[model samples]
Target: EIIAAIEGLMKDPAVGHPLKGKRVLVTSGPTREPIDPVRYISNHSSGKQGHAIAKAAAEAGAEVTLVTGPVSLADPVGVTVVHVESARDMLAAVEAALPADIAVFAAAVADWRVASVADNKLKKGAGGPPSLAFVENPDILATIAKHGSKRPQLVVGFAAETEAVVDNARAKLARKGCDLIVANDVAPGTGTFGGDANTVHLVTPDSVETWDRQSKDGVARALVTRLAEMIAKA
Candidate 1:
């Protein structure tokens, strides 16, 4: 009876759960830009952080939709998962899952793709190395964040930087038109790519707040709490 009373005291006074009935959309991992059937351009994102966030949001009672790129991690429980490969595919999936209450874009999408893909693999001895042209990929975060009709009420982006983390995040928050930017240092020795822990800075239009190093799951829970509070106040 005591434990039940304590739990009841800690529960939200309003909604049963903080994010009850809210729909959240999250993009995770790294989008690959294919060069050939066997080769592609991509990054080192493990989807651990993004997956953790989706899990935490589900725990918080939000209806979560996780749109992910190629990654090895298993899908989070109680969340709808959409697996995609290239940047274009990810963008299309995100568009199809629109009108969410909050959207967190955590995928490290490839910036460029080969302009012309070879039907056959270009051999090393072919013309003494073939030159390739590249073109920019669609900016998914910016497109969704600035959407006129289907934009989420709150849009968050991630900035993985090697230097000037907060400064770069601030710039990205403005450029991407997102409500917030979660910036982290993924430099050579940061162990942020596939590691368990992370140190992040929450950059918004008004200020920046730094968070201590913690496990990816811990960060996810903390972020969910913060977002829930923000929604309550809004």
Candidate 2:
């Protein structure tokens, strides 16, 4: 049964071969930064985009590992899935799954975490209010981009911007030291979160490719095809 599934994936036309025999790692969902045992900070990411990418990469004949944050989503077939909670945990999981040909940081990792987490949940009336201290979380994309060994040949990051989408994406591509950055606007009414469709700009070192808004599946397929071409040319 496993062999048949593998063969079926290999023969899928919507998939590509530039990534054949390669390994890909993808990070997805919103990382939780705990303030207390019962409270944490998180975002609204639904994990659809990253899951789609994982599925597409696997269908393209690549060994895909998805290091994901807590999300109520089903695992993509043919992809290895690792579940994590906090931003720090997600970073650790991605590092452990490394040495891939491609790494895509699609997770909306919280930039900051509580400096100290309370062992127990804070209760009202103990104090007027509880104060929280914050510290920066590790930049997983940058870390992988600059890994000492087995650094992926291609690194991709996502810029979920509410304004200045293209500009921010371009800056992130440079700042994160990734080969490409996909920028998308999450403005009100954009329907980026918990939506099946997306429109994004692919920012590279020298060019920006704007893709028409389409279903997440369509975007995933296109990205896999592009990755295949890049691997073939590399």
TM-score of each: 0.95, 0.92
| lDDT by residue for model 2 (144-183), tens | 8988676899999999999999999999889988899989
Over 4 Å off, model 1: 1-7, 10-16
Error of 2 at 88 (Å): 0.9
Cα lDDT tens digits, model 1, 1-234, are 999987877775445468889999999999998788888889999999999999999998999999999999999999999999999999999999988999999999888899987777767984696777999999999999999889898999999999999999999999999999999999989999999999999999999999999999999999999999998788
lDDT value, candidate 2, whole model: 0.90
Lowest summed-lDDT stretch of 10 residues in model 2?
10-19
- Which residue window of length 10 is worst by lDDT in model 1? 8-17
Model 2 clash count equals: 0
